[model samples]
Every structure is written in structure tokens, then in C-alpha cells.
Target: MTALGPLPPTAAVRLVKEAVQDAYADYGSEASRWLDGFTRQGGQVFCGAGCFGCCNMPIRLSLAEALIVRDALNAEKLAAVEAHARQVLANARTAPDEDVYVRRHRLEVGYCPLLDRATGQCSEYESRPTRCRDTFSAFPARYCTEGYWESLSPRDKRQYARDVARTPGTDGELHYIAPLEYLSEPVWEAAAGAMDRAFGLQVWGDFWVLVSLSARPDFMAAVEAGDGRAALKAAQAAGLSHPMILEIE
Candidate 1:
């Protein structure tokens, strides 16, 4: 078998970023077509500006996406992001499990660190990750709130079903949810697959974790030199090895 070697870190990073950007563009076109189909079928989209209920959830990103986001931030914003990432990592360490950790992170943070509190907008709106751009609520926007769903009991769930059944345009049908994962998962998979094949390394993780690691001087230097193992070690040292690391298959 021929031996495979890593591309120079700079080249690898560039390839990954380009692949992800291309994937994003493809996703945009696919999502638009899907949404159009949904609308044609009498489905209505309720997501709009100022509706940030879904922003509190954990967001995963490919290395390429993280690098793009990191590069777009100014020094002050980068510092804030680093601080927030540290807190997130700390919380991740103490939680009983991944689910518990994610829920706690949502409740504690209440919004993405990059979110503008006053405007309820992403600071890097134009360059926001694909996951963020793809998220949309099929039901009423209020139901999408973290607190609202977390508070739901069995009875509440039943009542919600009843209420949804009664709502106009939703009779016996699912509301026009964004189908975020359905649409984007393939894009992510393709991007990850391409990166892995190109770099001979796993290359997917939480957005903040990846972004934080990309900011490390040594980490980037190692990556620039096409040393995947060294870059992975740097990420591990920074406490980003958990849920962030995807399966190698």
C-alpha cells in the first residue's frame, strides 16, 4: 500500500475551508429548493428575525467552519469567545453525561456567546456556521424556546399535541419545520468525509471547541506543518477531545 502523508498545515486548512464553503453553498441551494417545495405543499415557515429560541442549543461545526468564524472575529470578540469556550469546557467536564452537559450549557448560557444580547443577532451573522443558518422551527416559535420545552411534562406534551392539531394550517400534518438535520447532515458528512480522506484524520467537532483550538498559536503552527497528530494532541491538551471528536469510520 502507498503511504499517505498529511498536506502542509496551511494547505490542509485551506482545502478544508474551501470544501466546507462549497458545501455551505450547496446546502443553501438545496434548502431553498426544499423550502419552496414545502411552501408549495401549503406549509408555512414561522422562523424570522428576533426568534432565537433555538440558538441556546449546542452547535457542532467542522474545522473549516470554525476557522472561518475565528478569522472573522476582532481581537476583543475573540477574547470573549475564548472565555466563553473555557466556561463551556469546564461545564462539559463536570456534567454527569453528554445530555446533561448540553442541557446545562443551554440553560446556563441561554444564548450563543457570539449572539448580540441587545439585538438577539449573531455578531458574525454573515459568516455564521451552516448549522445556525439551517435551524428553523416547524411549530410555533414560542414552543422552540429552551425553557418551554424543558418544562414540558407528559400532560403538557399531550396538550401541545392537541393545541397543534387545532392550529390552522397544521391539521393532521407536521408544520413546516426547517428539516435542518435532514438537509444538512449529508452536507456535513460529505465535508467531513472529504477532509478525512485528504488529511488522514478525523476532522469534526463542536463549533466553539474547534474555533478555540484554531486560535492557539502552536496548534495552527502544527497544522500548518501538516502534522495531524500534533494538532490533535494540542486539541486534547485544550480539553476538546470529548463529544467534539467524531467517530473515525
Candidate 2:
């Protein structure tokens, strides 16, 4: 057999790109299959594409998700995202951690920042978190937890509250409903880590901070400054789009 030679740098880069693309395609296919199954089992559950109910909430995301959003933003978008993040950071500093849950629930009544008011759809759908992806309709058997709640029955709700207390990450908010079981935590975490490594640290941290900061107005304004396109890119890179906060104010 002929001896193999070292590949050129350009060829290697192309190979890596192909590999990444393949992996993404495979993972996306799997995720789509799972979502399809979940949707089917729950009897055709959908939040409606134009419905912005979930976008208005102060949803939490893993660091990797943050990076994906940041990378999606160009220079202008990066600035906007950063400014929004700072605003959120300011608010988070004063608010009691428990109170945040309450605020998140009420936010559904208001407009969401990422929402396109005219369309009622999230502007950034591709980069949304797994939590958003996994949310299913209120079907008990097909869905992960059908009647697991505190709102339906007082005694059941109280018991659920006690159970949540024992569970570290479980939230006890009025509109807060989780679709998946506890085991999903590790799976999502691993997915997030893989995303982080695929992107760079700068992209990841910027996305994380911006989403966290979208609750603040002052910061978002900073992002909205400069050339509109440039500002949008900067804000997006920083995860700083907080027009929703301004609307509420």
C-alpha cells in the first residue's frame, strides 16, 4: 500500500467543518425526533408560533446557549445584548432570589423583548434553550408530569411545594411548570458544555450575560446606540436586547 501523507491546513479545516456540520445534523435530527414524539404523545401540543407567552418570561439558560445567541449577533447586536445584560445584572443584584420567580411568572402578562410584537413570535428561535424546546402541552400520560402541580389542588400543591423544597433546582412559582423529569438536568448540562466547547469562551460568556441582562433597560439602551446595525450586532453579541424592559417601564 502507498504511504499516506500529511493533510494540508486548508484540507484539515474543511474536514473539521464537515465533521461539525455532520454532528450538528445528527444531533438536530435526534432532537427533532424526540420533540416530534413528545408532541404526538401529548396530542398535538403547541404554544403557537406567533404566541410569545414563553418569550416574555425571565427564562434561565445554560452558558453554552448564551454563546450561541452571542455568536448570532454581529458587532452592533453584540453591543445591544451587552447593554441589556448590564441592565438585568443591576436588577438581579437588588431583587431577592425568591422574588425573581414571582416576577418571571408575572412577566407573561407583559410583552417580551425578543418577541416581534406584530408577529408574536420570538425573533431568535434557533438559539432558544432546551427548556423552551422541551415544554409540552398539559397531557399527563404522554407528557413527563401530567398533574404534578400546586395550583390544581391545595393539598396536592402543598405536597408538591414540600417536594420541591427537597429538590434543589425545582422552582415553586405560580406559572412555572417543568415538563421533563430530574434526569434531564444532566443531559441538558452535557449538551450545554458541548456547545460551549464548540463555540469560544468569549461567545459563550457574552451570550450568558446578555440573556441575564435583558431584564434591564439602561444597559439595553447602551446597546441600541451607535449605527443601528452595528449597535444591534454589539447588543446581540452581549445578549443585551432589552426593549421589553423599556416597554414595561
Best by TM-score: 1
What is the model-wide C-alpha lDDT for candidate 2?
Answer: 0.42
**CA lDDT of each prediction against the hidden true structure:** 0.69, 0.42
Cα lDDT, model 2, residue 3: 16
Worst 10 residues of 1 by lDDT: 1-10
Give the best candidate by lDDT: 1
Q: RMSD to native for every prediction?
A: 6.3, 13.1
Q: Which parts of model 2 have CA positions greater than 4 angstroms off? A: 1-28, 38-42, 101-112, 139-187, 191-249
lDDT tens digits, residue span 13-45, model 2: 233233433444454666566556756665334
Cα lDDT for residue 127, candidate 2: 60
Off by over 4 Å in 1: 1-9, 161-178, 224-228, 239-249
- TM match of model 2 to true structure: 0.48
| Local error of candidate 1 at residue 11 (angstroms) | 2.7
